[model samples]
Target: MKYLFAILHKLRPLFPQSLVNYGYHFPKAYLAARLYGNPGADLEIIGVTGTDGKTTTSTLIYHILKTARKKVALISTVDAKIGRKNLSTGLHVTSPNPFTLQALLRRMRSQKIRYVVLEVTSHGLDQFRIYPLHPVIAVLTNITHEHLDYHRTMGAYMTAKLRLFKSAKHAVVNKDLPLFGEINARLPKVMFSTYSLHESSQLKPDNIKYFQDHTTFTLGNTFYSIPLTGEYNLYNVLAAISTALLLHVHQSDIKRALMSFKGVKGRLESIENKRGLHTYVDFAHTPGALRAVLTNLRSLKKPAEQLIVIFGAALWVVSLVVYGKRLLSNLIVLKLST
Candidate 1:
């Protein structure tokens, strides 16, 4: 399948972009999944897609389902798991090509896996990479400025995300984001639930507290805590918990699973050292993600402590440029105050 795509890519210059997309890419992917025995139809699949937190949210959902004694699998940017077997993706892409994805799902189905949690990306949705598999539950963490380089506009980017909801039986959305209204308006045909920091949301958090090593918050009268610090993480937890509730997992089990989750790597991962200086490594690439991570780190530091940040630029150069200037200006202010 990949060989065919490679050959087509070489001839891509001779064809229109739409022709390559609809004529070649979509058909090739769909047929590959069909050849794989249509594995997606054998299990309940949960797809989590958004600008940020897809990996973390998917991982958390997988963990919770596993803790509930369900035979489950996880496919995320960090790794893919089927029971005891773990495979590193070895690539930066969140969603793999259709051939790779379908093959993995076939393996899981053969092992009698009951549920599969997948991290869906806008690119995958737009390209029809996750073809032919309708999700049982779809989750949207939140939409922000991202992937404009490919989609060309926020409306197009959002439309790509909305594709997931269309095929899903149920959806869990972040009510705190302004996009919630738009998403809700389009979900009349799909059963959906919402979570938020606001009091009116179906799943809302209260009595939030952040510590250097962990965060604690209350969902209803039940207290939950995780060893991941930051308000953004709190939102990720909300999404996971909401999904679990919709799946009929008990509250006690949800709390237990959350307490045991160490967290996903490269997402605000902390490093220890002999010196007292604190450091963290995070995969926050978008402007919204960068701001969230930086704000969380800043809140963790003492007034006299220096907060240093290093970033890598790859895709989304426009967002990086805008964030870079703003970050530098803020750093200068911090320096002047010190």
Candidate 2:
């Protein structure tokens, strides 16, 4: 990507237009309508977004919805599975083109799928790729600093995420974040529902418990727990469970689905845990993502236990950090507060 950018710089003089210059660019919805028409019109699109856990939540939602025998088209970072057309992440979908997204949604709609769960990223939202699909249920996992360069500031990054709730009829959020109240206050007309550590008195869900083998939680009179570990998964699972119940999937089915879920790839995934010293790893490369994983581990740690953090990055971010070694050290000491 850096090499491509360097080459583009050299050729900038010959070409008189910016690489991404779009003149009166058609909104994704319009392009979607023109090419793929409208698939999300009848199907409920539940958009899941945040710094982390989106893939897990989305997969869980897809499982429960699929278990209930509802057709679903899923577009997540892990993969894009629309009906029988399931493809791996290696497929061309890192920020899908407007027409491609519209076509996918339209395909799902054509298959008579009842639901679609799209994992919306800040970059995808910023690009107006999904402008056509007005989600019925928007699930915001949580927000933290991740895409600072692209967004320029945390505020702009947040604004990109808020675009999900802009058209959603019911927005589900993790109200535990410090920014939750501020974010909710600025949104458009929508019925707000929240999933949190603190159970809402008005909401149906009452007490919740996170267990090693299975997490048992109650909403109204019924108790539910899927076979899963990690406290973060519990919260993310609940977010999906809450959304599923709201969609009126049977409590028994929901319970069954969670119990049987095998889990998603690369999410707090077990790599190699040696004697007492667990070397658990994840695909967390961004500052916010690193913070989220660290926070979860910190919460899970026993008192007096030491938590060691060694930072590294993917190829691109690694280059950035390597090139800006002095800046990185200064920022770590001054700007990053944990």
What value does the lDDT take at residue 273 in candidate 2? 50
Tens digit of lDDT per residue, candidate 1, span 1-338? 56877898799769865677788879978887888988999989999999988999999999999999989999999989998988875588788888889999999999999889999999888878888889999999999877665676889889999899897988999889987888899778988788888747888888999988899988778988898889888889999998999899999889999999988888888788999777788887666777787778788878889777665453334565456545653554344332
* Shift in Å, residue 317, candidate 1: 6.4
**Cα-based TM-score, every candidate:** 0.92, 0.77
Residue-level lDDT for 220 in candidate 1: 75
Total clashing residue pairs per candidate? 0, 1
TM-score of 1: 0.92
lDDT of each: 0.85, 0.70
Q: Which stretches of candidate 2 lie over 4 Å from their true place?
A: 1-29, 89-95, 199-213, 271-281, 291-311, 314-338
Q: What TM value does model 2 have?
A: 0.77
* Candidate 1 clash figure, as a count: 0
